[model samples]
Target: MKRITSFILLLTLIIAMVFPAPFAFAAVTQSAPTTEVPTTEVVTTEVPTTEVPTTAAPTTEAATTEVATTEVPTTEANTTEAATTEAPMMTTAAPGTTNPDTVTILHTNDMHGRLDAEDGRVIGMAKLKTIKDNVQPTLMFDSGDAFQGLPLSNFSKGADMAKAMNAVGYDAMTVGNHEFDFGYAMAMQYKQLLNFPIISSNVYKDGKSVFAPSTIIEKNGKKFGVIGVTTPETATKTHPNNILGVTFLDPVASVTAEMKKLQGQVDAFIILSHLGIDSTTKLEWRGDNLMNNLASNKDFLNNAIIVLDGHSHSVIENGQLKNTALLAQTGTALANIGKVTFDLQGKNATNITASMIKEADTKDVTQDEAVKAIVETAKANFGKATSEVVFHNPVPLQGERSDVRTRETNLGNAIADAMEAYSETGFDTAGDFAVTNGGGIRASIDGNKDVTVGDIIKVLPFGNTITQIQVKGTDVVAMFEHALSAPTIEKDGQVGLDANGAFLHISKSIKVHYDLTKPAGERVYAIEVLNKQTNKFEPLQLDKTYKVVTNDFLAVGGDGYTMLGGPREEGPSLDTVVRNYFKAADMTAYQSTELQRILAGTASENVPGEVTTETPTTEAPTVEATTETPTTEAPTDEATTETPTTEAPTDEATMVEDTIETVTTEQPTSIQDTPAASVEVKHDNVIPFDQAVKQKDKSQHDAKAQTDKETAHQLPITGEAAGTGAAAIGLFGLGLYLIKRKSA
Candidate 1:
């Protein structure tokens, strides 16, 4: 039996070796099934041995299954972590397509009703249109003063200016001081004609908004907020009646309020300020000056990203203000255009660049046909009156000066002469002289040149009608005294006549000489009136009232001539007189004499001869022998050796002969005719009570004073306040940190 069992075990071992543990069990089952034995009986016999074998199978299967599960979980966990880290990065990297980083803003300031270019250095509406067409998605804005410089603007009462601007597609504009030239009603009418928005943050009427406080434009997904601030000084500089019911608020305060309101709403902020730059420091700061106060106000400086300045006619390169904000001015008369570019994101500005639109670069640019048509139509309606040259002048004339109303210019003299001539010819009474305020002349005429109608208009741009007035010589002297006494006319602490007296250009026949060293009121040394008929010079008689010719500006006492406005007798219009003079003097005979000849006079026996003469001789005989000579007897003693001698005439007979000769010699008269009438003018010198009050108020609110006050207040209390706050915060934070650290 033992031998048989061993042999059987050996066979089993061989089977196990050949089949492996898993197949050995499957083979046993197959073998059992073929024999028809119960599978349960076979499994029961092999259970303990099978369990041992399955233990190894379970270990291997468990290891393989654990590896597969671990791989899947690790891969899924890694994928989830990666997705969580990358999502925020993608969101951060993409700026929405609608972001406004590509917006451009184009602006102009102080166009001053210049529909056409002036001096060949300016850009007109046509050129402006070309620029607009070339720049896409551009918003055009005028800072202010778009009207009131030329005849075209004045005759149409700003209608033509508005139409021209509209034709060029202006997007927005602001009101300037000159807009009130014709009065607020006219300004309102002009506003009505504009197709674009008009913004004036400070100007108000009857507590109602005459114009919007600000304008918002959305272009290229970018929002631009623009606010306008007219200088408060307008109240004094412009006619008070025009702004009678209006009140001008502080520009800094107005802008600050507007900016706060616009925050989070616009991507960029712009301020159109008609406030001129300060003359003293050239820095933007708050001071008594209107422009200084506006510029220096912290609120405005901080809030505005760009300031398009006007009135002062300044140009800024690189667009920097306080090294923070961007600022620009295109000067006056369409000389240049201002351009600003901004990169914006939603309501925030990221980058900015600014440059001036130069006239040279755009000179040949095509003009807008629409604006051109409007200009042409206006011209056609006005006829030659708008374009004709009034007369020709040999010298240039200009009216601008630092402080004084008078300027030294040949043109000024010519204008005064023309006025005087006109008054004399047109008026019934003998006009003593024609006088004009130096400020009346706006430009210089090139001497001896054909003065086109355009040149005449430029020189007399105010379009003031001439008016005749009668004043005594005393009153004329008083006007001169007032001009000299005015504090504004002084320079360098010394008040005296200019070397050229260019500011006081006067006509012929009236002579004025003043002492340089004399006090303001006593400067007039002498005044002479010329008798045109007899060609005689005579001193002015203070007691006698004389008729004078002057423009309506002076007759109404414009430019601070109080004397003229006070009880001045009325006469004919200066325009009528001038027209009459031109009529009397054949237009064909109108010839411009040398400035020197007009200033001096023709040479005479008593005067030096022509400069071109080769030789000069004295015509008056030398007075060697004053006494009459006695007759000498020709050695009458003929018998004694008579000497021949001539007898001199007796004193009585010589006197009679001299008297007869003097009587026979008549004064030389020239063919040139003199006008009959004389006109005297006085300027308005009285400042209205309201204007004085406003000036006082402005002085009190000087930016320098406000800044000083702020500095003083801060110096005393800021340190203490900061110390207390810092101590309290420090204690609280210390307590919290101690508690947290202790807990940790």
Candidate 2:
């Protein structure tokens, strides 16, 4: 019995050795499933483990290939971990199935510092957050000018606006002219505080980009290249002193150069443009004009998908430019928010749809609690005196910005009269006429309504002072010609109104008639000046000199008037001037004068010479529209690599954590090191504003004088002095040699 039991125990031991533990078997199967066979090895080596769901089992050759590409990991263990922890980047590629990826872009432009709209119907950051929360695979961008309009924005020099935008989550923004309202230093400060990039391919400082030229962001395993473009007119649109060290390249040139760098690096291209769509804006600097210019090259436009534009406050929704790209812009003040959806198949955009959501329609939308808190804090900090009524408006003034910029309005006359009255007190002389640029007038008050100091400040925000300068009659005519030199739209061979900030608003002391049928310089047919000595209107003499009352801006060549010298004497601030005028006039019996200061004509007339287009000598660079085929090489597809990371929240106001399940790609090239217009730079020299102006003025004259002086001073010591010293040195050397020989 014992022998039999021993034999049975041995057999049992053999069986136990043959069959391993359940946990050991489990470990063998789960730990190295990625390395089981040739097929599994291929999957582990080439594909990302995160791309494949852990629950999905490969059933066919196609599924094997798909699973292989699911998640590419450096190690077998990492592959298993990725399969378990990471979400799939794409939907399962079933047999003979094609799926397109969808991406949503939310865009806003020209908010103009109206953060909290007095009218709830106007769109604000709060409503924007609600839409962002509902939308998936979304990105948010601003074309430009988020600040510099409302009291909230201006009071903080755009600091508060930056904070609010940061709280709401803006991915990127292009530079705008109004961004320079608080000066370049302030703009840089705002950019530093914001979480997103302030990008502009064309804007440069000291031979380097003021902001990054472009950024490549990935969503759903697809890459998008966003390029920023700002209008070259920013130089003139803002104060010359504001952007002292900045230079703006041609938008077309900058964009094409940047697009070449992003061609193979990104799946799609988008342009965040602050260049408005209006054709009359500064000689082909408009968005449409720029698109047409770029469309000349089909290859460049092939990758371009959309342009979000601002600056002219014109609305163009879902409009196709050159049939190559989609374009959209919401008018000023956030009345509407633009949205575009791109259906991408592989790397190409298969379909695109554009639309706008009006703020009024979104009244029931939920406001983001975080953004609401920020805005509330700003409003609470604003003083109560801003709402106090400073004076009563007997009648509604015709001072809407559009009207003031494009035509002669009664409000323009009243403002000009106030400036003239103030200038007379400062100069102690009767000036010819008070003139102001239309851009100086920002808002108008309703007639028979109580006007507050805040209202006046909004209308005249720049704080310019009344000043007087003596100018010749010929210079005055030249100034008038400059005022009317802007290109006007042609309607039946007659010039029609176009928006130009340099358009002049004059006081009652001058009467002028212009014929649109005539050439630009010869358009002025008649001019009459009120002779203060004779108290009657008389023909202006070209040689006669007149003391002109104008704003300090105009005196220093703020507009296009170069001959108009800088402010000779300063008076009260513009707002103060207007307030003093209001105090002197009877509040209950105020009446705006119906003055005929300017008359328009439709017929042609004879004139002297060809119209010269020379503007005042200012720091702004003159922009000319030109077309040239860019010779940039297309980028390679190896520029980007996909990763298993999720995208960050575009609108953080509503969501602090990123719940987005996506695939992000890292760009191989860094924009900071390689600017679009980069050149080998040895030094970053900053030229002082006044010194630069002086150097520019003396450049030609100093050339000859500098050369002569350099040539005369080329030799440090004269030949005659050298010859005498050489003879003395020879005698001393001989004496020393003789002494040395005697001593030896």
Best by TM-score: 2
Write candidate 1's Cα lDDT for 10-92 as tens digits. 55545544443322222111233353311110001011111111000112112212222211112211111122111111011
Q: Write down the worst ten-residue block by lDDT for model 2.
A: 647-656
Tell me, by lDDT, which candidate is best.
Answer: 2
Q: Could you give candidate 2's per-residue lDDT for residues 1-744 as a string of tens digits?
A: 544554555555445444523332221112544644322211010111111111122222222122233222222222111221211122211122133377778888878766675454356777677777666325789999886666556656667788888877777888887776665566677667787877777676544456667777665567678888887666555545555556666565566666766777777777998887554454445676556555555555455467888777766656555554777777667777888887776566646778777777787788888887877777666544356566777766665554555567766766776666665545667577778887777776677677776677667655455678888878888788777765566434544555556778877567566666667775665566765565455556777988888776567565445667743765655666675566454432224233356656532232322211122121111112112111110110001112101100000010001011011111111101110110011111211212333356578678988886676444344344445445545555555555555557
Model 1, residue 127: distance off in Å is 1.3
**Residue 583 displacement (Å), model 1:** 5.7
Q: Count backbone clashes in candidate 1.
A: 51
Task: Give the TM-scores of the predictions, in the order they appear.
Answer: 0.54, 0.65
Worst lDDT window (10 residues) for model 1? 649-658
> In model 2, which runs have C-alpha deviations exceeding 4 angstroms?
1-100, 428-430, 487-495, 586-595, 602-744
